[model samples]
Target: MKLPILSQEIVITLQQLEGIGNKTILSKIGSIVCSSISTLDDLLSFWGNLKGKKFEAISNDDIKEANRIAKRIISRAVDENVGIITYYDEEYPEILRQCTDEKGKIDVPLILYYRGNLKALQIPGIAVIGTREPTPNGVKAGEYFSGEFAKQGFNIVSGLAVGCDTTGHVGALKVNGVTTAFLANGLDWESIYPKENLELAKRIVANNGLLLSEYPIGQSCGRYGLVARDRLQAGLSKATLVVQTGVTGGTMHAVNATIASKKPLFAVEYRNDVDISHEKVQGNIMLIREKGAIPLRSNGIDSAVAIIRGTDYKQVTVTQPSLFD
Candidate 1:
């Protein structure tokens, strides 16, 4: 499953270039690197054609720094047993290749660093996302729906954040189901965000799940990175479920990305008896009322399962007696 050694080196070098991480810039570079060039021997001709072009303006110093960084990245990846999948690699996920933004711009990452089963990406899955802080009801909903989906053979996809996301992964693992965690930082343990999820991440890998990232080794998580990571979570799934969320947060970003990508979105609906004024469930209401997201009955795993299976089911508002009820 290894790429040609030379191709791997060249791809890593391109990733190390400053400003190449930008999707538009990376797309342009990818066209050249994946098309006219296949190895380091072709880099000269590729560089010569765009010496003064705006997108191809890499200085000599930039090349030197890129070489150094690429070497370090390669060394670290090996030391950590992290797997690298470039855009041109055959192992790259096909679903990711079709992802785009609201404006129809391609939003796929140029490379991915992963640990554990790459095969898990090929399985049917749904992204489960929600607020970092969730009400007890929201946590139960996440666990119930995700665990139900896992039992039905759907891999759970989510960002490794706290609250609902953590519960989602735990639910899947409870049933010995596969799950994939899309990280906002590098795959290295030193950069795993929240620090608390380090054990959770390990459990995922141990349970045949995947820990994936677009950043290279040593990169730290940042606001923009987390925002960007949301797209991959949506892109990787057949559908996205918002267990609970406030109007503003990473969960909303994932919802927007799912809509932009034209994936099916299901938002949990709290029963009328429950307090709807809670900020945690505001985003779910907004999504259902404003964004046309299908309303998922509270604690109704069958409704979610039917949708994924493409069977006819009532989309009418459903309800759960309580969070765990």
Candidate 2:
């Protein structure tokens, strides 16, 4: 079968596989289909016709949730002018293509529901995520790096949540740099969360940044949705930095995803003791020790910027543009 036909068929089939992980199922099918497996029927038969196999046990409510997501995506795609990006789409991030499985299955998402311009994917991005409620130190550090990283030409990415995440976005804006917010809730590309950042989110777009989500527009925010959102924020970036987190927090999820994707992960370590309740600290330590993430210097903004920009750490001499006297 044609590649487009096969890809389309597999997407629909994976979409219908209740209780099956969409990414996992798509990964499997993607491996075969990408390798010259002919058609959906041939692919299904090869896999023992797993398609349409009823789950041994699942409530109607569970099925309804899946349907709700599907329907919401469809309705909002039309109603809110959203666009659907499948793994096969040309605009799929090339960075994610590096994450191939042992069986040659890529970690690419099956589909990404999007509502904004695709330009953000081409820019070098740094994700900053941490506890929802941060300490004063965490908040200060988050702002510092956010501005520093943006000045280095890295587009800052974060959940639009309060605390460190929000600070990251604002810091980027303070430098007059671009930033993108990846949301956990289903959002029309134009929508902003926490209501307060609504203005900030607007400024980002006006500055040629974007607001993005994988969920269909209008889907309610859920715990799992936030978790899913974190993965995308990590996946979409060249590297990630956790400014401050408690022993357990969503920042860890983003860190883990960065590790699993084999991208560079870095942590901003405060000189003082980081609290466990903050939920981002332990994860950062674990990532550094076990996952090999580097510990970034708290005071080396210039050095970090030099490394990112591939230039010497010296301040550049500004050349004044000549104007009519």
Number of the top candidate by TM-score? 1
Q: Write the per-residue lDDT of candidate 1 for residues 147-170, one digit (tens) a residue.
A: 888998999999889898998899
lDDT of 1: 0.80
Residue range with the least summed lDDT across 10 consecutive positions in model 2: 316-325
Q: Write the per-residue lDDT of candidate 2 for residues 1-325, one digit (tens) a residue.
A: 2333244334534475565676655544555543543344454444552344444343445544554555545665778765666667677777655543323334556667655556877888888888777777777778878898888788899988888888899889889877888876555634446677777766777777777766656666778877767777877777788876665666777777777766666776544543433455666566657766666655566555554455532342223321100
Q: After aligning candidate 2 to the native by TM-score, how far in Å is the CA of 57 from where it should be?
A: 15
Q: Pairing residues by index, what is the TM-score of model 2? A: 0.70
Residue 187 of model 2 has an lDDT of 58
